[model samples]
Target: MTKLGLEAKDLEPTRTIFHSIVSGFSCSPIGRIRLDLFGDSSHFRREPIWFEVVDLSSAYHALLDRPALAKFMAVPHYAYLKIKLPGPKGLITVTDDYRKSIESARDGAKLAESLVVAEERRQLDRIVALAQEASTAPIPAEDPADKTSFKPSKETKKVKLNPEDPSCSKYVVMGSRLDNK
Candidate 1:
């Protein structure tokens, strides 16, 4: 492979190893953990969860079976780290631009809500002003036709639903027939 920078092979064994460990180590907001750890229908949907890089290499070395870690990885895991990022919850990440984006969303929502509220208040103020004018205005002498036209309708209508397919109640599915009613 073509060498870049100081060269990949030139990296110290320990430094290279540390970088590997750091790359694998991850953090996550608790909500993601509860989604995975708790379950699909879990109640703690919005909680923050945190995780840290485990020193598993140390554990393997302490066990005097360093190769076992690889073997352990071979087994199918009923429970395993989600590990990857961005699909709802796997790892925690932070960046200047990402934080700014989150803040921007919150600020934008608040600004929108405030603007809506202010407009609603302005509308209410106008309505109040109109009400005050109407209350103070001289009442017009009532016309006879005005009283008759304001009456509520006393007529009633009946609506009935026809049974769906009298020939086949068992096989006829509900939503397929749009004209049943």
Candidate 2:
């Protein structure tokens, strides 16, 4: 209607903020409405828009039925839900498009998780194969000392041990325990 001029407002989730804007809007005759919406990660964290914690594994049926129940859904980063409201005389039909944010978040998270799992599985398989190869391979044996050509020195003495003598008990021969005769 020849540019009725644009009206802008910032609405918060709380009643105080909503009431300030809504009250003013409701009183005036409704005209064409154009909404420009955007939000950061902090907005989602601050607002209670996202669903509460849910068990992703056991909640399979629930997750399939409700997108908000999916744990992998990304936090809302930004959104735009522009609506062209009808004047007092005009009529317009409105349907929900907010679910798109949650669906996109869930799909993105699922794709990222799948990629990570695939990489982890590939690394695990490589480690398992290496372990198997190590188990089957024979280890090289250490070389034994050569004693075929070795001879005992003449200086080495062998003495018979007397059980009655305490001094003889202290002596050990050839790295073996002495037996008292």
Per-model root-mean-square deviation over C-alphas: 22.9, 20.5
TM-score for each predicted model, relative to the true structure: 0.28, 0.28
For candidate 1, the lDDT comes to 0.37
Please give the TM-score that candidate 1 achieves against the real structure.
0.28
Clash pairs, model 2 backbone? none
Q: Which regions of candidate 2 deviate over 4 angstroms?
A: 1-97, 143-181
Residue range 1-181, candidate 1, lDDT tens digits: 1221233343323211233222333322111111122213322123232222222322111111224323222222212412112224433322224444456557656655665687689999999999999999999877787565565344533322344655643432234324535
* lDDT (Cα, tens digit) per residue for candidate 2, span 46-112: 1123211221222011111134313223232223433222323342222335676467557656755
The clash number for model 1 is 5
The lDDT values for all models are 0.37, 0.38
Q: Model 2 — TM-score against the truth? A: 0.28
* Model 1, residue pairs in steric clash: 27-92, 29-49, 30-48, 30-49, 31-47
